[model samples]
Target: MEQISSFFHSIGTFIHSKHQQGVYNTVCLAILLGLPVLIFLFSFFICCHCCCCSRQRKDSSSSGPAHGKKRKKKEEDLWISAQPKLLLLEKRASLLV
Candidate 1:
């Protein structure tokens, strides 16, 4: 804490010196405005990076070395798509037939 205070105090003394008034104001204004802009951009970048990484991780993990990708047979694909309409016994029998 004391070190931080001394650092700022040194900066204050430097800025308050006769030749540096504009330097002081400019530095202060830049920090005041630019700090928030920097924070917003950093947060936005982190959020986007995290979301993209998560999606990639999920996709890769699902298709990783252990669980290989299995292609469904055409017959299986047909049954899967027609599953919603298979409620009727007659329709189910017709399909089997």
Candidate 2:
């Protein structure tokens, strides 16, 4: 624990010397702290979302068989709608490259 603190203290001194409090300091601080917290939160949100979606699927399937067809149709429609945007992205990427 003491070694860890000293290591971080040394790194912080190095960065602080490079930039004496400005946008660079703010960006460094965000990268050092905010990024990890945000990553953890994002992963947690995704995990909860997947679990809730799975439960809903199980409940819906058990409650109704016909609704599954409607759900599939909706999913297909969404995919069809998204294809044009995907193609546009590919075109833009190819042009940029």
| Top candidate, metric TM-score | 2
Residue range 3-30, candidate 2, lDDT tens digits: 9999999988877775676887768876
lDDT of 1 at 41: 100
Error of 2 at 63 (Å): 0.9
**TM-score for all models, in order of appearance:** 0.44, 0.45
Error of 2 at 41 (Å): 0.6
Candidate lDDT values, in order:
0.76, 0.80
Supply every candidate's count of residue pairs whose N, Cα or C atoms clash at under 3 angstroms: 0, 0
Candidate 1 on 1-97: residue-level lDDT in tens?
A: 9999999998777656633566667778668769999999999999999999999998988886766668866535445565466566445544454
- Clashes in model 2: which pairs? none
Total residue pair clashes for candidate 2 = 0
lDDT (0-100) at residue 40 of candidate 1?
100
